[model samples]
Target: MIQGDSVTETHQGILKLRVSSLIALLFVAAAASAGCSEKMGSAFAPSAVEGVVGGGQLQFHDADTTSTATQGIASGGKKARWDALPESEKAARKARMAQRKARWDALPESEKAARKARMAQRKSRWDALSESEKATKRAARKQRKARWDALSESEKAAKRAERKTRVRIAK
Candidate 1:
């Protein structure tokens, strides 16, 4: 009777050890699968540079310098930048814009009319908003832009990947 009791205790101990080892192995496997470089918080966060012209290449400038640059562009007009570009670059840009315009022109008349109507409706709605409401909307836009600018490259990639996945699933 004493020998049987001892055997049972030893078996139970081994079973407990196996269970502990299995749990630890599972934890290690899960961590490995999650990738070492990804931060949990940023995995699904939106990128800070979504609509920027050069994407991740955006440069920061002091307020005065930025305003001056903006003023230069605005005052000089968009034509100035076009004039500064090399002839070959200008030709390529012109070709691209022409292609886009051609595509727009090729759209069905009803579709074009619908788009125009939608734009007019949107403009009317915006115009109807109170000054404070417009200010709030602008502030929200700025906050989103700031948040998008704050994301790291890896986080941005994660967000893009998530967006692609969502789009694919929706389709």
Candidate 2:
């Protein structure tokens, strides 16, 4: 009977030690996880060098990107910095842009055909609308314009961004 009593006491002491060890391990793990999370936070945080400083203000700046990373900014030549560009170079760019615009303005047959089809479709849709439906649409447009005019600048910016995102996704 005395031996049996000693065995029970030993089991209880073993259980207590196991529980205590588990608790200590949990605490250590929690502390380690917290330290790791803090380190990760700092790692992802933006550094001071990632922005432009002007008038004691820091503005975030993104690096310029080209479609072909290996290619230079123009015809495998280094891009001239915008602020430091020579007047002659600027004039040449402007002339090139004007030439491109002129070429675009000379419409191709395919574009003309597409434009005609679009106009025809728009006319047909307009003809299909009842007078009451047209009135309703006009009222809706006025309401939308009023609502847009009432928006704050920041809200308008957000709305424009949302519209651009929608257009991109649609394309």
Candidate 3:
């Protein structure tokens, strides 16, 4: 009878051990699945990965670092090195930029489209010009620049005023 009881106690112990091991395995599986969910970018939680992810590039953005958009490379063509420009050129460039911004703001979508189309047409025509024609245009441009450079400061100011007046009238 004692032997029979001992056998029954051993069987119960084995059963308990199996249950504990199964519970441990289930917990391990759950923890592993949680890791997988993190990698998959679960909607319930924010993704661990940051920055722009596309085009086979993995950029990691940190709090102190500026975004690629602000650096002006991937978003569009490279920006001009503003710090390298002469002070005289910088003011003129700034004024021209402001004027362009104002003009762009004032234009309706249709007008903007028309302007873009006109620019495209002009570019196509320029591209179609023969090599000799291109050279002639370049020579004419150089001559105009030389003539402008030869003018006195007063003459240059007059020319600028005249150009401004012409532009205002055209607008």
Q: Identify the candidate with maximal TM-score.
A: 3
Give the Cα error of residue 57 in candidate 1, in Å.
Answer: 36
Best by lDDT: 3
Candidate 3 per-residue lDDT, tens place, 82-144, comes to: 666789988999999999999998998799999899899888999799868987998999999
lDDT, model 1: 0.59
Cα-based lDDT for every prediction: 0.59, 0.57, 0.61
Root-mean-square deviation (CA) per prediction? 29.6, 30.8, 27.3
Residue-pair clashes per candidate: 2, 0, 0
Residue 93 lDDT (model 3): 90
Off by over 4 Å in 1: 1-96, 152-171
Write down the worst ten-residue block by lDDT for model 1: 63-72
Which stretches of model 3 miss by more than 4 angstroms? 1-82, 86-92, 165-171
What shift in Å separates residue 48 of candidate 3 from its native position after superposition? 36
- Candidate 3 yields a Cα-based lDDT of 0.61
Q: Candidate 1 residues 25-116, lDDT tens each?
A: 55444544654222343222222222222222212233233211121134223556767899999899989999999999899889999889
TM-score to true structure, per model: 0.40, 0.34, 0.45
